[model samples]
Target: MKLGIIKLSVLITSVLLLAFQPAGKKPIKVYLIGDSTMSIKDTRKYPETGWGMPFAHFFDEKVAVDNRAKNGRSTKTFLSENLWQPVLNQLKEGDWVFIQFGHNDESPEKVGRYTTPTEYKTNLTRYITESRSKGANPVLLTPVARRSFDASGKIQETHGEYSDLARAVAREQQVPLIDMDKKTQQLLQEFGPEHSKLLFLQLKPGEHPNYPNGVDDNTHFSELGARLVAQLVLAEVKAQNLPLAERIYKPDPK
Candidate 1:
C-alpha cells in the first residue's frame, strides 16, 4: 500500500510540474509582398541584395519574415496569378502582411502590367479587406524611390499617382502606411547624386564576373543600400508602434 501511495505521489508531482512548465510561444509571421526592390535575389545577383533579405534577419526568431515580393509583379498581376491566395489561406490571427506594389503598376508603358489608378486602389482595398477577414493586419507601403536626380542635384518624385493612391487606400482602410518612396527619396537626397551611386547596382565593366558588360542600375539596390532601406522600414515599424516591433531583435546592453 505504501509503494502504491508513493507511485501516486510521484505521478501527481510529475503532472503538476508539466502543467506549470512555460508554454511554447507561437511564432508571428510578417509577410512582405512587393516588387524587385523587396524580393529575394538569385545567387548570380550576389552584391545586389533586396531589402527583404535584410529585413528577415532584423526580427527575433519568434517573428518569421516571409518575403513574397517578386521581380516585376504589380498588385493586379499578383492577384490574377493567384499569388495572394496562398498567403491568404495561410494567414492566422495576428500575422502581418506588408503590401507594397507601385513600380510595375505605374509603368503604363508596360501594357502587360500597367494597372490604372482606379484598379490600383481597388486591388489594394481587396488586399486590406481579405487580410483583415482572415484576422491578419495589412500594412500598405508606397514604392521605394528610384535614384533619379535633376542636373541641379535635387531628387525627383518618380512614383507620381501610384504613391498617392497607396496613401489613399491606407487612409480609407485604416491600415498602417509606410511611405517608402518619400523616405528613400529623402535618403538619396542626403547622399546626393554622385554619392548615392554607392547604394545602387553601379558596376564597372570587368569589375564583376556576373555582369561582364557592367550595370548602371539606379533601381536595384546593392547590399549596403538594401540594409539601409531595411533599417528605414524598421525605424518606421518602431515609430508606428506596430505590435510586431516588439519582436525586433535588439542587442543586449554591453
Candidate 2:
C-alpha cells in the first residue's frame, strides 16, 4: 500500500507539472513562390543555386521555407498550371507566403508564360487574397534585378514595369513588400559593372562540365550570388521587423 501511494503521488505530480508546462511555439512555414531566381537547382546544375535554397538555413527549426518557385514559371503559368493549388491546400494560420513573379511574366516572347500587365496584377491580387483567406500572411516582392550595366557604368533597371506593378499591388493590399529589385540593383552597383559578373552564371568555355561551351546568363545566380541574395532577403525581413525575424538563428560565417 505504501509503494502504491508513492507511485500515485509521483504520477499526480508529473501530471500537474506537464499540465502547467508552457506550450512549444507552433511551427510556421514561409512559402517561397516565384521564378528561377528563387527556385532550387537540380544537383546536375552544380554552382547554379537559388536564393530560396540558402534562405531556408536562415531560420530556426520553428520555420520551414517551402520553395515552390520553378525554373521557368510566370505568374500566368503558375496560376494556370497545377502549382498554386497544392500550396494553397496546405496553408495554415500564421503561415507566410512570399510571392515574386516578373521575369517570365514580362517576357511576352516566351510563349504561354507571358502575363500581360493587367493579368499580372490580377494574378498577384489573387495570390494575396487567397493567402489571407486561408489565415496566412502574404508578402509581395519585386523580382530581383538582373545584372545589367549601361555604357555609363551604372547598374541598369531590369525588372522595370513588372516590378512597378508588384509595388502597386503591395500598396493596394497593404501587404508587406520586399523591394528586391532595388536592393539587388544596389548590390550589383556596389560590386561595380566589372565585378558584378561574378554574381551570375558567367563561365568560360570548359570552366565546368555543365556549361562546357560557356554561359553569360545574368538572370540566374552562382552559388555565391545565391547565398548573398538570400542574406539580402534575410536582412530585409529584419529591417521590416517581421515576426519571423525574431526566430532567425545565428548565420554561418562562410
Per-residue error (Å), model 2, residue 45: 1.3
Candidate 2 similarity to native, TM-score: 0.94
lDDT digits (tens) for residues 1-254 of candidate 2: 99999999999999999999999778999999999999999988878898999999988888899999998999988988889999999999999999999999998799999999999999999999999999999999999999889999999898789999999999999999999999999999999987888889999999999988999989999999999999998899899998878889976799
Model number with the top lDDT: 1
Q: How accurate is candidate 1 locally (lDDT)?
A: 0.93
Q: Which ranges in model 2 have alpha carbons more than 4 Å from their true place?
A: 251-254
lDDT tens readout by residue for model 1, 1-254: 99999999999999999999998666989999888999999999978988999999988878899999999999999998888999999999999999999989999898878999999999999999999999999999999999999999999999998999999999998999999999999999999999999999999999999999899999999999999999999999999999888889998899
lDDT of 2 at 138: 95
Off by more than 4 A, model 1: 1-24
Candidate 1: deviation at residue 143, Å?
A: 0.4
Error of 1 at 184 (Å): 0.5
